[model samples]
Target: MKLPINESGLAASQLIYGCMGLGGGWNRDPIQSEHITQAHEVVELALENGINMFDHADIYAFGKAETVFGQVLKEKPTLRENMILQSKLGIRFPDEEKGLPARYDFSKSYILDSVDGILSRLNIDYLDVLLLHRPDVLMDSREVAEAFHQLKSSGKVRYFGVSNMSAGQIRLLQNNCNEKLIVNQLEMSLDKIGWLETGVHVNQVAARDNVLPEGTLEYCQLENIQLQAWGSLAKGIYTGRDLENAGENVKNTALLVQRFAEEKQVSQEAIVLAWLMKHPAAIQPVIGTTNLARIQGCVEALKVTLSRDEWYTLYVSSRGVSLP
Candidate 1:
C-alpha cells in the first residue's frame, strides 16, 4: 500500500485521509474539545489501518481542522514521527482590507506567510509536502520558485506539488522551480469521468467538446507525477439523491457499483475507490469521510481488484455512453 513519491524517495500510503470535515464543520467556528476528540479518533483509526498520510489545507474549516489535529499531536507527541503530513496554500478568502472577491495568491510573500500560518496552526516544525491549492492566473512562476527555494532551504517544506492545475500551468511553474513537482490532485471519480472520457473520446467531434483539459492525465503519468484523486467516491452515489432523482444512466451505474460491492463482499465505497486505483498512473484516492466505520470500510479497496472488462463496464456506465 506504499507508493514512492517520484524521485523524492518518500513513501506514502496509497490512501490519504483528507481532513476537510474534521473541525466541526467548514465554517469559522472555534475548535472545540469535541472537535479535538473526533480528530484524534480519526487519526488513530487511520494509522491503525495503515493509512499514514494526512491531507490538509489552510482553508479547511477555516483552519480549525489543523488546529484540532495539532491538539492531537500535542497530546500524543510521539505520533508526529509516524505520519506524513501535507497541507495546501494559496487560496485567499475575501477580506475587508482587500474589498475584493476571493482569489488565489502565489506571490513570494504570500506563499511564505501562508506556510508560516500553516506551521503555526498545526504546531509543527515542517510539512512533509506543501501543495499550491489552486492555479492563480496572476502567478509569477519565478516568485513562486523563489518562495519554494526559501521553504526548502529553511527545512519548512520537504516536497512541493499543486492541486487543480492544468498541464500547462504545472509546466510553467516547474520550468522555473528547482524542485520537481511530484503530485497533482484533481477531482476524479466514477461519477466525475471527464478525466477518463477525454481520453476515450479522442479525435472525433465528441473529443473537442470534453470539458476536461486534454493531456493532463497523460502529462502527469509521463512526468511521474502522482495523481491524487479528490472526491474519489463521488459522494456515495448509491446513497445520494442522484440515484433517486437522476436519469436511468446514473441509477444504472449506481446499481452496478452496488452489485459489484455485494459480489466482492466489500462496501460500495470500496468498489468506487478501487475503480480509480486500477488505473496505470497509480492514482491515490483521498478519502474525506470523518465517519470511522466508513473510513475503515474504504480499506477494502486495497483488496478489491477489477478485471479489464469489469473496469470498462463501470467506466462506460458512469460515462453514460459507450466507447466509440
Candidate 2:
C-alpha cells in the first residue's frame, strides 16, 4: 500500500528513519568525527533497507543531529536528489539565563527563523516537509499562515504538517493556511493503544478512559493526511527487551509476539511493526533504532502481513482486555 504522501507528489518511503538516535547522545557537546561516521552508517543502512524518508527535529541532540547529518550531505551532495528530508520545529527548551520556560512557539518569526536554522544545519536548500513539532496553545493561525506562505514562496519548505496534534487542532490551523497539511504524526504502538481503543470502545463505558484525540484517526484518513507512528517499536518491550519488571500483560504480549515471530519465521521486530501497519490508516512506522542489526530487523516488517485474527489477537493481548 502506498503512503498518502505519494498523493502529494513526493515519493516517500513506506517506513521513515527517525534521526532522534543520531549525533551520539542528546547533549551540548560538539559533534565528533565518530558521530559523523555513525551518521553515514545509519544513512547508508536505511537507504539499503528501503527507507529514504529521513525524519528530524531541531532539538534532537541540541542540533548536533542535524550537524552530523550536514556532514553526510557535505560528503555526498548527490544524496539530496534521492532522499526526502523532513524536520520539525516549534519546541523550545528552557533557557534559564533568558528566564524563559520551555514552551512551544508558532510565532511567525520563530517559524521562519527555525526553518533557516534547520536548513543551515542540515546543509540543505529546502525541506521536503516541515512539521510543527507540537501544538502551541497560544498559536495564531494567521501568523502561521503568513510564515508558511513566506517559506513556500521562498522554497524553504515544500510541504507542511503537524505532530501530536488533535483533529480539531489540525482543522483550526488548516482553515487558515493556504498549504495543505499532508501529515499527522502521533505516538502509536502496541504499547500505546489509545488510538485503537478510541475506536473499539465507542459507546462502551471504557470509552471514557481513552485519551486519544477524538476523531483523529478518521479525520486524518478522510483528509488524506498520512498518519506517522512514532515510538512505533514500544521501546522494544514486545521485541527483545528485558521483561523482568514488566506487567503481566506486556510479558504475555511479548511471549505472543515471540510465538508469532517463530511461526512466521521472521524477526520479532517484523511482528511488532506488522501489527501497527495492519491498520487501514496506512500508518508509517518511524523507527529510531541506530543498532545496525535492529535496523535490519525493522525492515523485515515490510515482508509480513498479518491476518485479521492475528492482528486482533495481538491487539487484545497487548491491551490486556477483552473486547466488550
Candidate lDDT scores, in order, read: 0.91, 0.92
Clash total of candidate 1: 0
Top candidate, metric TM-score: 2
Relative to the unseen true structure, what is the Cα RMSD of model 1? 1.3
Taking the tens digit of each residue's C-alpha lDDT, what string does model 1 give over 4-30?
A: 889988889999999998989978767
| Tens-place lDDT digits, model 2, residues 1-324 | 335493678888889999998998988887788999999999999998778999999999989898899999999999878799999999999999999999999999999999999999999999999999999999999899999999999999999999999999999999999999999999999999999899888888888988786699999999999999999999999988999999999999999999999999899999989999999899999999989999999999999999999999999998887887
Q: Which ten residues in a row have the lowest lDDT in candidate 1?
A: 236-245
The count of residue-pair clashes in candidate 2 stands at: 0
RMSD of 2: 1.1
Clash pairs, candidate 2, are none
Instruction: Evaluate residue 158 in candidate 2 and report its C-alpha lDDT on the 0 to 100 scale.
Output: 95
The number of the candidate with the highest lDDT is 2
